[model samples]
Target: MTLIDEGTAYGRQRQSHDAEIAEVGAGTPGGEFMRRYWHPIALSAKVDATPQNVRILGEDLVLFRDRKGRPGLLYPRCAHRGTTLFYGRVEDEGIRCCYHGWLFDVKGNCLDQPCEPENGRHKDKVRQPWYPVEELYGLVWAYMGPPNKKPVLTRWDTLESVKPGQKIVATGSSQGAGGDDTVEIVPTNWLNDWENIMDPFHVPILHTTFSGVQFVPEMGVMPEVTWETASHGMRYIAYRKLEDGRELDRITQALFPHTRIVPDIRLIEGPAAGVGWVVPVDDTHFRLFHARKVPEDFKPIEVRHYEGRKWSELTDAEKQMRPGDWEAQVGQGPISLHSEDHLVSSDQGVASLRRLLREQIRTVAQGGDPLGVTFDPARAVVKVQAGNYYRKK
Candidate 1:
């Protein structure tokens, strides 16, 4: 892709991801559009021993765990002489730049500049190139939004789906489900995939037609799905429970700005019932991370190839493979063109998501509250009858 000239707006010239606006990212409005929330960078496990370099929102970063079991996110370079911090050593406090011994804490606070003044130091006066990071739901998240207004971390029922005891006592239980060690990344753009998490209407079509059947027989009965904003992104509460119509299906929720509570976890050798997270690498590229805890008898398997450079980097071949999402979004162009979109009633989920997104994005700009503002831990087995495949009349 050719670099857009300064002040030159760039986006899909054709029917893209319903997007045409340039100035959305970085110097453009597109980059600024993405700089509104906290983005996840790595699985918590990635922050051990050696530092891991990461790129998010077009910025380079370094990740590592401290000796005290604290994970840190820092600028890729040392403030001193601009040394790359990815080669830094993990210490009990934070990551220490291997060169000149400049130490920085997880928050990027310069702790020790050994080459500088001795006695207790003036390191606290300086800050290294870094951002605030938090470990939640088995991943390391960093806020690339504004220097302030970082939203509170929202929780999801899936994290508590399994009993704590089940985690410790279950024999040979795959810890990925209930534990905090498993996090996988699928490269793509945030909008293309994040929209999928909210729109369940695609499964019976895309997965069944293009890919293959991945849903249960009960899924054949697509029920009418109703959506509402909650402590999370949007809740697609199904009006129909199942094919049998007896048991009430629990609500499917997407935690804003990313992550979802899937009814199925792809635990078995086949795709199990599962939840997924769409993490932003930048406006153009992102990742899907799914941590599953399958049945003791189930074994999940799949293969993914990493051919792209970081989140902000994409080769033409990598661009073509944009994964399934690429075909869904970019094929439409840089942004999906809404003007050319002929949405049918089947696009209900997509309609709802877009409506809510437009609303929330406006709210965010006006300094108003976004969805999933303050979570209520009221767990209920609500009967959700979403649009499932029902036998036609």
Candidate 2:
């Protein structure tokens, strides 16, 4: 018998994903768990008179603002003739479909049917499907869960207290930071980016060592790290010794569901001022929405350069050499196959995150509320503890 080389891929079987934690379509285990809380669907400025088409959780919906200045999220199809409401005209009362003149309010109520007698005597009986929308922190949030299970839209304490010169700013950009040249929607599984927030080990290796100090010189220092389970989600503290005999203690949190609370990577010496949401457009595509407090004319996302070239200016070969988060996460494929991952002791944070997500999925499946979601108005505001601190040895 001929002996074959060990561990060759010639006859290896295909890998499988952890579907319970990856799939995010309606009725899926992960989808149901994600629906338990509100998600930022669009920037407030983008939803105006003209309807904007959006896809979230594998469902296509239209978002618009009625002439009354109320934001609405509705099923794009007209209930009467099945025509898309994308071409509908915005009127003071509601949106009027161009096909049959059917009108719908922000709550999906049928206001009128102009093509029928007495504006359609049975108009009150017809309704269009819609999700509840609320504007907060310069972003439009939607609750796509069961009506009875809807909770208050969460407010972050870090984004609330704006000083005299500072105001709440929001972005729906690539990685929640990149400029116009970057793709607004990330082409990868949501879990790929979501789990990354917990894996602090990557910063020293990927951002500093491999990427050649893409962030800051201090980040190049290997940190002493510890992880813990926080009330909302998981938290990690990384301590790095500086050349001046001072230690930098950075605290970051991965809030329940898909929120990331990270201190300003510029090593800003204060509490974190922003939060980012990794929202799933589907099982394979995701987008980021971030809100932070900054002074007027301040651009929150700093343009990054590698090898003396901006990210957008790099060639394919250059990208391969100096890949950032976009390349790293998306390279894991649309949905990473969990069975193929060789996790180790350094991956404790990633493992813990997956376990927590599975627990939440099971919780929702058992008809119980998931963690970090509260219906009480008093508990709607969540305090952020992620920040940068300094200590002298």
Candidate 3:
């Protein structure tokens, strides 16, 4: 067990992952916990007359808007012959299966069966699978849990208090961070990115020092950090003293389920203007949906640059030279094996996030409601406490 033989890569073994907190399928603990809250499935602008295939929580679904202007999400298979509805046509009533010309409404109610007698004498007996969907904050939210357990779609105070001429702009690309260009679907487990929200120490190291000032010079200063558990999830505050004699308190939050409310990287004052959701496409892939308040005709500023080139403009070699979150998270492979992680004092936030998630998973396993979910409309709006504040020392 000397240095020559101990802890060597020659015979090192890979450890198993924490599947209970990572797997997001129909019946898994993590999936069931996620189902307790509504998640953004698509940008409202993306769901149009053309049927688009989407996968969420490990289920394949088709999303489209009917001629009546109602958005619908349904199982892709035709109820009769199992043909994918992706080839189906959108109609005034709903969508029509190309196979037998059977028509179903947005709610998956069979409306007509052209080949059957009397428009299908038993058409009423067949129903296509569908999920409950609603449009809010420029995104389509869906509830995939038990119908009786569906809670009111929670709203955010930050997004609701839009001033005149300001609107909530929703982006579903590039990890949904409001970036104009970047990878859409992240090829990794959702938890990898979700956990990163709590680990603020990486900002100064990875984005600043390692990536050569990706955000701003102020972000490069290492800060003293503290973590706290909120009713919804958990939050952290990073304290830094600026050269100009102002104490900076940057607060970031990871809300229950999968929402991250982070202050602007430039240390903008006031509460966080947007929220991002790490949505699981399946066990190995995920996507991000973000909604933020901005002025009319607002354009995204390219702040993260490496060697005088924007992230989207960088070549593969440049990306490696100036790695950012995408490189760090995706580099962890499809799923970061939790068993291999060696926790440190600085990883308190990451540790707390995992603990919170585990508690919710256990709550669902015991047939109880998870955190941050409510049936009361009066309590549906979540008040965000994340922001950047400055005080004179």
List the candidate 3 regions with Cα displacement exceeding 4 Å.
1-3, 175-182
**Candidate 2 TM-score over all chains jointly:** 0.96
Tell me the tens digit of each residue's lDDT in model 1 across 99-162.
Answer: 9888888888877877666823677777886677887657677776666556555443434455
Q: What is the C-alpha lDDT of each candidate?
A: 0.56, 0.88, 0.89
Lowest lDDT block of 10, candidate 2: 174-183
lDDT of 2 by residue, 150-233 (tens): 998899898878888888889888744222336688888999998998888888887887667877888878888888999888
The residue-by-residue lDDT of candidate 3 on 1-393, one tens digit each, is 665556667867878779999999988898888888899999998888899999999999999999998999999999998999999999999999999999989899999999888888998899999999999999999999999999999999999999998989998876333123566788889998888989989999988887787777988888999999998999999999887787999999999899999998778788999999999999988889889999987997655566666667878788777778888988888988889999999999999999889998999899999999999999999999999998754
Query: Which candidate has the highest lDDT of all?
Result: 3
Off-target runs (Cα >4 Å) in candidate 2 are 1-3, 176-181
Q: How many backbone clashes does candidate 1 have?
A: 49
Residue 304 lDDT in model 3? 56
